[model samples]
Target: MEVAEQRSKVVEAYIQAFEDRNAEAVMALYADEATVEDPYGTEPIKGRDAIYAFYQKAMDLNARLSLDGPVRVAGDIAAFPFTVRVTVDGKRQQLEVIDTFRFDRQGKIIEMRAFWGPLNSQEI
Candidate 1:
């Protein structure tokens, strides 16, 4: 697979998969030993199963993801700015986030990093 050509497609799929609350579809883009570190500072969940579980929990909450800007691709990594809106206890919250996905030669995401923090989120 061509990394440059496929990276944006995979990123778009990821956004759709998450918005669809389809953890399995999200996992399908990951490598067997992929890692995910949402928000970047905490411990990264490693391996496919762990990553799936992580996404499962969030998707279960009915999180909706939408791109805020164009996806940027550089070498093996693709980055995008987005907003995740979810309702908690009948209150809607939105978080502004940026995520970087590093792809393997086969075009599967090998590592995913999300950049966000408390300041990036607020009740909506």
Candidate 2:
């Protein structure tokens, strides 16, 4: 699927922010009232402050993501699949993750949701 030209830029910003571990940069990609559903088991986290906390927790994992393929935009939303390689509790793990992003008319992400599962069946 083809990502909207404008939204593609915003997605790039998100990936760059993640790679940099710059919370502020990550927040910039979202609107003030943006909602995120990372680790989807929990309720959707709303607003920039909550989103900041989510990213902060992720940063604590010392995580880094390698995205696959271009962003797939469908209407006002887009999705990109990624694999995160991180070391938590002295063990390295690969996580297969899918990130879905929603954008407002102005192109700022109004909502960003992420879900993931362990690449290996071994329980952590």
Candidate 1 Cα outliers beyond 4 Å, as residue runs: none
TM per candidate = 0.95, 0.87
Clashes of 1: 0
Off by over 4 Å in 2: 1-3, 118-124
Candidate 2: worst 10 consecutive residues by lDDT?
Answer: 115-124
User: Model 2 compared with the native: what TM-score?
Assistant: 0.87
lDDT of 2 by residue, 1-124 (tens): 3348777777788888989999899988788888887776769888777789889888878888888888888899988988777887788877778888888876788877787755432323
Top of the candidates by TM-score: 1
For model 1, residues 1-124, the per-residue Cα lDDT tens digits are: 5566688899889988887889999999999989899879989999987888889999889889999999999999999999999999999999999999998888899999999998999999
